[model samples]
Target: MALVRVQNFAVSLDGFGTGEGQSADAHFGHAGDRLHEWMFTTRWWQPGGSGGVDDAFVRQHDVGIGAEIMGAGKFGHPGWHEDPDWRGAWGPNPPFHTPVFVLTHHRREPIEMAGGTTFHFLDASPAEAVDVAREAAGGKDIRVGGGATTIREFLSAGLVDHLHVVVVPILLGRGVRLWDGLEGVERDFQVESTSSPSGVTHVTFTRTTA
Candidate 1:
């Protein structure tokens, strides 16, 4: 059976996944690369990088993933809908080698990019989109790519089976938060944590039940 997982999701110490004033130029806004610095140090990012605990977790991102679901914010910046030629921030070939469904209310045709990644736009609920992505996954897991809001939705809907979060040591003060309105969310899963040498903490939540 295919599972739904959120992997390598980085957040600040203050719980902000991304900073304020997000634009095409600043995808992560004021938070910048601070949130993802841990992944950059991993060998998975480059051959000469560290191949320690962080690398091990980063490597799991594609272990069983066949399809991805992301929010429009993760697909592009604020005014991306205005540009008809916007392929994505990932140039010609995106990192996602699977079909990607972007959640948005606007209707747009699917974009077939280089590599196996194809961008599919959909206006649907979390459950509905998961249904479509799971079918396309070919029995592999579905990755819930995030920009905070998208992950929160799937988590709130109780559709996520596993979640991996990296808490970077920094405070954004303000931006998009990942844990809002998720009171008592830990009750649904078995949570575990491990601290990295770089001061970042890796947290995993495996669903206790269906």
Candidate 2:
């Protein structure tokens, strides 16, 4: 069966996904690339990168994923909708080689980019968007690429089947957090974790509920 998943999402010790002050120049905001430094060192990111547990887990991010659902914030910086020429931060060929649904109130026409990625703007709830992405996935898994808010919504609605998070040992005093309003969320999942020598922890939440 096809599943809804969140993969390779990096968060700070304080649970912030991306720090404050997001912009075109700062995709990760003030926290910068610190949150994802662990991922960057993985062989999944580069040929000479680490081939340990981090690389193994990061490599699974693309496995069986045929379509993706991401928040507007993940798609672009604040006020990106205002720019007519803005094609996203990934340039011509986005890393996601599948249909991408971007959640936002201000919906725009679908954009077809290089590779198999196509950006489709949607003004829908997490469940509704999942339904749409599930169809596009053709029985393959649906990936929820997030900037915090989007992942929280799907988790709150009990729509996520699998969640893989990389926890970096840092504190972002202020930023968009992934754990707000999600108290006691571990009750629904089979949680597992492994620490890497690179000072990062890979956490996976497999939904146990039917």
Q: Which candidate leads in lDDT?
A: 1
lDDT of each: 0.94, 0.93
Write model 2 residue lDDT over 1-210, tens digit each, in one string. Answer: 899999999999999999999999999999998998888887878889889998898888889999999999999999999997888899999999999999999888999999999999999989999999999999999999997999999999999999999999999998999989988888999999999999999899999988
TM-score of each: 0.98, 0.98
- RMSD of every candidate to native, in Å, equals 0.7, 0.9
Could you give candidate 1's per-residue lDDT for residues 118-190 as a string of tens digits? 9999999999999999899999999999989999999999999999999999999999999999999999999
Worst 10 residues of 1 by lDDT: 38-47
Q: Pairs clashing in candidate 1?
A: none
Model 1 TM-score, 2 decimals: 0.98
Model 1's number of clashes is: 0
Worst 10 residues of 2 by lDDT: 36-45
lDDT of 1: 0.94
